[model samples]
Target: MPGWDDNSLGYHSDNGKFFCHLNMTGIAFESNNLIKKGAALYPCVGFSMLQKSGIGGSAEINFGHRMLKYESITNFDI
Candidate 1:
């Protein structure tokens, strides 16, 4: 989620890849201690750009969904 390479001149010659992601989550009937049951809706988006030697650069975007567990209301990744 962080970058160390300098691209101030708009030139990125890295041989690896650059990645990013965004997520939004909604929950209802959830308590502060996460001891109550709740319904949740989450939408996640991700993007990546790859630059390889003599291969140029490519970019991609992806979307996915996550369901909330009734047994575990404290988990955000699920």
Candidate 2:
């Protein structure tokens, strides 16, 4: 749980919810979640697997050097 600890925040991709420290029941913010001023944030990714037979998952990372399929957000101020 990314936002279970202090100074941590996370956005749940499946349910479109946003979580902030100790907030287990996150709020619905979707893609418009904003960061507080002066908050130092970093980019990260995580994955998990369920305890079940024949369950599997994979992740692919792109560092922006290749052509993206969709238009990227370009209005970020910082």
Candidate 3:
């Protein structure tokens, strides 16, 4: 994970009805998976886009947060 202690820059664009949220997440944590951590901010109107690029696969993701996670599998028998 990298560091976010430095000055960060971000933006969110809108074309009348839709929006795209941009973020530069340089904050690093003491964990192997950086995606598992972040600072949640205010919720706004319309659609949004948040991108995070680093050393990790992108398929492991959830569409939205929830109170309880419904997993198809947790452990393998073999």
Query: Each prediction's TM-score against the native?
Result: 0.18, 0.47, 0.15
For model 1, residues 1-78, the per-residue Cα lDDT tens digits are 113334211212356764322224433332223344335423332224455544443444343355433443434656
Tens-place lDDT digits, model 3, residues 3-75: 2224332332333453233343533232123343445443323322355543333333444675436643424
* Model 3 RMSD, rounded to 1 decimal: 15.0
**Model 2 Cα lDDT, one tens digit per residue, 2-55:** 544565555556777755443234322322245434434456665556777657
Ranking by TM-score: 2, 1, 3
In lDDT terms, which candidate is top? 2
Looking at candidate 3, the ten consecutive residues that score lowest on lDDT are 1-10
Query: Scored by Cα lDDT, where does model 3 land?
Result: 0.36
Error of 3 at 66 (Å): 7.5
Higher TM-score: candidate 1 or 2?
2
| Model 1 ranges off by over 4 Å | 1-38, 53-78
- CA deviation > 4 Å runs, candidate 2: 4-6, 14-41, 72-78
